[model samples]
Target: MASPLRFRRSSERWNDDRIIEELYSHLDSNLGARSVTPHYVGPDGFETRRFEMDNGDMALFTWNDDFAYWLGNTETPPALWRTSKYTFDEVPYQIARWGQRELLADLTVESPWLAKYDYLSWFFLPVLFSKDGRETSRAFFRKYDAGFPDTTRDEALSFYERFLRTGALDDYRYTMASKLGTSQYFDKNRMSSAMSEFTVAKLLTEAGYDVIPEIEVTTGHSLDFRADPRNGSHDQSSLVEVTRPQPPTQRAADTPVAALRETAETKSNGQLNEHGGGAVMFVDCSGFRDDEWSAVVGEQPDVRHRPAVVFRARPSGAIDAYKKGSVPLSLSQAVEWV
Candidate 1:
């Protein structure tokens, strides 16, 4: 696998002209799948560039203030892909730094020959940031777009299944969220649920819990995850069910906060009852009233097994594991479970 050329901010003196030459030279040499050419270097000191990807689609970027912001596709309107930026000091193109590490492994398994150019992450960045990022990405890379090029729904599923056979779960997640910008599959409520689950899953993984998504327990019941505690070995595994109250936009103009809490509780109760155990329920309290949230958290789930503790996921990503809990855990705290 080829390693993408990495750039970092350094105190070393930089020759602007020489640096631009090296960058363009590197792209031309490394990008075997794409034709990279210098578009123009503006007098204002920003360098504009264009890339024609493997599938013949083109995108543009400009390097300014040590950051590269994608302009847009060759012919597409700016209305689709918002201007997304990448800094030279950080891993380029990826929304999260952790993704860079995973990307290397993905490239090894999927396209080892392309590994050399993986560092040219910008080659893939624009499409992923656009409204139809996923679609454009798939099209540009010659991957099967879910519903395009006259492919039927069944054929699309087959392509999806094949891809899922090797694609990482996190990739699926990132891709799904990107695709949701234009997908019909996720409406308001479903999008809320998806976001809550994704947030909790990310936090759990950060906290060193071996978390699995949508682990099925019974015939019709699937919990969000069957999580192993911080330590690799644990006597008992935990089933975690996550839910979020109505999003701010979805709430009725006249709906009281109490009604929203009730709605959240109902969803939590269903999971607790079906799971019938000490499964922990994580409720996202993003838009719930303060008093309503307190009341909801104060009440416990009544189940045949032991009662469950309801944790509130605050708007700022902090976790209130329980009412009056002393030790609050940050999303990235993975050393030990709080």
Candidate 2:
């Protein structure tokens, strides 16, 4: 999938004057894009300009040395047409830095409430600052604590910030980050469900496995993740489908175990059932506290599937989890078995 945040790299040798004229002609003719004089000198460049289109799209162009980069929510301009695109990390460092600064500026402009958070701002830059999702994405984190209930906002943000800093999902930023945004605006359940994938990612990588997101199966459904052992030891990978049960207090099920069982059963009958059982089901009970988890651990109710793992995680890198039905991956290093 082409992500919204990728950059189009151009090595065309058009002189500076001709380049600007061509861009202006193409943009103005096609998108009614208008620009003011560039106010900043980008990395190794004479100027960087932001163009606003009549269709509510914004594009940024920065020229430095012999190369130019085009980035925006809009389609690539004719000037950068036929150029190969690169992700944030795949571009030159200076280009990446300048583009990030431009993107960061857009984010701050759209959601000033996020201006104070340094880590959260950088980690979700792609989605939180994206043209379509800027407002909704910021609110998901700002108001919902990124979907962690019973935890302070600071606690939740700080925990996830550390995980993101590791760059585990950096390559999949557009697809993963935008998931938080493109949901129904401020729809808590859908938005929280998106964050559960990230939590599972943190768990899988910490267990010495590489987690690949959005794996498509023959059933025409995308499983949440594919965990391959990071070491060269394993030739096989494990498919994982994650389900996060709403905390007991907020759901129809009166008890924590009852709520989890209900949620897991629903998943077991749906996607996993259609998948026909190779994937492991991950039940994220992170919303539960110590007392709530104690009842769950004692019962360890069947999730109606084989190769399922049930666990709770805290933001401080402390995880208590257990496996059922012979899970192939070894997670004992990252998780303390309950």
RMSD of 2: 4.2
The model with the greatest TM-score is 2
List model 1 lDDT by residue over 122-223, tens digit each. 233323334334343333323422222233433433433333333324333433333224331224454445545655664566565656666777647877
Write down the worst ten-residue block by lDDT for model 1: 1-10
lDDT accuracy of residue 269 in candidate 1 = 57
Model 1 CA RMSD to the hidden true structure, in angstroms: 16.7
Checking candidate 1 for backbone clashes, the offending pairs are 2-115, 2-116, 4-119
**Which parts of model 2 have CA positions greater than 4 angstroms off?**
1-40, 51-59, 63-70, 73-93, 105-120, 232-236, 289-291
Q: TM-score of the candidate numbered 1?
A: 0.41
TM-score of each: 0.41, 0.78
